[model samples]
Target: MEEIALHILDLVQNCVEAGASEVSIAITECRRDNLLTVKISDNGRGMDQATLAAVTDPFFTTRSTRKVGLGIPLLKAAAEQCNGSFTIESSEGKGTQVVASFALDHIDRAPLGSMADTLAAVFAVHHVDVHYRHEVDGKVFMLDSKEIRQLCGDELMHPRVIVWLRAYIEEHEKQVGGEQ
Candidate 1:
């Protein structure tokens, strides 16, 4: 993916496909450390050691719809190309967590594109609850879909609510210096 947000979208979709009811995405940009880290955790049907071991292989996938899986492998390569690292932890029935870090100032580091749109798109369609947090330096912006659902009640999927969500996410992204 050309943008880190696209990578995030892909990973989150994977979590949804795995039957996740909740997902948490955290992005931390530490200029002092020259690091941009993304961590995604999902309460989904996770993998066993054997599956987890093969997740990084571009040719391996749990899906029958496609012959190859490139999401995880591509993300790993993106991080490594920027002189950073990627790691995943999972258990058969528990959940999964994926972490990818990139050197913030690396020449090859991808931009974080259209995050507000990404969040809005995911939130609008998926039934899963999501908690998104973005931290730049020490400032943080957080958005929790659970809270929104509670506030909106049965109107959670109303058109106005979706618009509100997009606007809210955009404001937060701007506050955290992640506006695209």
Candidate 2:
């Protein structure tokens, strides 16, 4: 993926396919440390040791649709290209967590693109709840689908609600780092 947001979307889809009911995405951009870190956790049926080991292999996949599974491998390569690291931990019947970090100022590091719209789209189309926390420098902006659902009731997917969500995310992004 060209953008970090696209990688996030792909990872979240993996979580949903794993039968996750809840997922948490945390992004930390620390300019002082020159690092951009993304961590995604899901309460889903995780992989066993063999599956976990093979997840980073492009030719290994549980899905029968194709012979290649490039999501994790591509993310790992992206991080590595930016002089960063990628790691994943999972246990059968427990959960899964994926962490990818990149050099903040690296030329190869991808930009975070349209995260708010990504979140809104996932929430509108999927039956899962997500907690998105973004931290840049010391500022933080959080969006919890559960909270939004509670506030908006059954109209969580309404057009006005999506508009409000996008606006809210934009405002928060500006407050953190100005136009993410």
Candidate 3:
């Protein structure tokens, strides 16, 4: 993926497929620390120890469709290439968490990309509850799909509403992250 947000979308989609009802995503950009971290946690049917161990292998996947699963491996490579780290943990009956960090100013670190579009795409399809938080330095912007469902009566799939949500998220992202 050319963008971190796309990677995020792929990871979260996997969680959704795994029967997640709630997902939490956090992005922390700390320029002072020269780090960019992305964490995603989902309340879903997590992997067994055996599966977890093989998760980073491109040849292993829970899906029956294709032979390869590249999301996790790609993210791992992306992080390591940027002089950072990647970690994933899961419990069979509990959930899963994946965290990838990148050197904030690394020459090869991918752009964060349009979180607005990424999130809007999620809401457009799945009804999963999503809590997303983005922080740059000390500034923060958050979006809760459940809260929006409550306030807007679950019209997030509406075309007009999706447009509004994307624009809203983009504006907040620019404000909190200081112009992308």
TM-score for each model: 0.95, 0.95, 0.97
Query: Which candidate number maximizes TM-score?
Result: 3
Question: Clashing residue pairs in candidate 2, if any?
Answer: none
lDDT of 1 by residue, 1-180 (tens): 889999999999999999999999999999889999999999999999999999999999988999899999999999999999999999877899999999998999889887887887787788889999999999999989899888887677777788888898888788889425
**Number of colliding residue pairs in model 2:** 0
Candidate 1, position 144, lDDT: 90
The local lDDT score (0 to 100) that residue 83 gets in candidate 2 is 96
lDDT per residue (tens digit) for residues 1-180 in model 3: 989999999998999988999999999999889999999999999998899999999998878899999989999999999999999999987899999999988999899999999999998888798999999989999999988998888677898998999999999999996425
Model 2 reaches what TM-score against the true structure?
A: 0.95
- On lDDT, the candidate that comes out on top is 3
Off by over 4 Å in 3: none
Error of 1 at 159 (Å): 3.7
Which is better, 1 or 2, measured by lDDT? 1
User: Measured by TM-score, how close is model 1 to the native structure?
Assistant: 0.95
How far does residue 60 in candidate 2 sit from its true spot (Å)?
A: 1.6
Alpha carbon lDDT of residue 80, candidate 1?
99
